[model samples]
Target: MTNFDRITVDPTVMSGQPCIRGMRLTVRRVLEALATYSDRNELAQEYPELEDQDIKQALEYAAASLDDRVLELN
Candidate 1:
């Protein structure tokens, strides 16, 4: 699935931050959980509403965003 397919952005939700399937959870939140918890099963347990793919797709979206970037020196 594409990045936008699993992730959503709405002005009414989280101030338009990227969310999971229009839910209140943000990609940053999930990534933070992954960084701290460091266990997929534990994260799944913490946020029972999300599946493995949701977290996976969040990561995919972040990675894809970096893939399209260019850094410049002034």
Candidate 2:
């Protein structure tokens, strides 16, 4: 998925932090929840807006972003 499509930047939302599908849910929040929670079912239960695919997609998005990064020193 394109970063522009899956992730959005809107000043009104979370101070323009990158979010999933322009929703109020930020990627950082999602990742944190995933890291702390062991049960996907429990997570889905707590976050009605999220599904298994959403969680998976968020993880994939994070991974892709990390993989594409190149540190440059000038």
Q: Could you say which candidate leads in lDDT?
A: 1
Over all chains combined, what TM-score does candidate 2 have?
0.71
Worst 10 residues of 1 by lDDT: 62-71
Q: Write the per-residue lDDT of candidate 1 for residues 1-74, one digit (tens) a residue.
A: 47368899999999999999999999999889889887778877899998878988998988877756578989
The per-model lDDT (C-alpha) reads: 0.87, 0.79
- Per-model TM values vs. the true structure: 0.81, 0.71
Task: Kindly report which residue stretches of model 2 are placed more than 4 angstroms away from their true locations once superposed.
Answer: 1-4, 67-74
lDDT string, candidate 2, 35-73, tens digits: 877887878787888766667777877887785668999
**Global lDDT of model 1:** 0.87
Top model by TM-score, which number? 1
Measured over all alpha carbons after superposition, the RMSD of each candidate to the real structure, in angstroms, is 2.9, 3.7
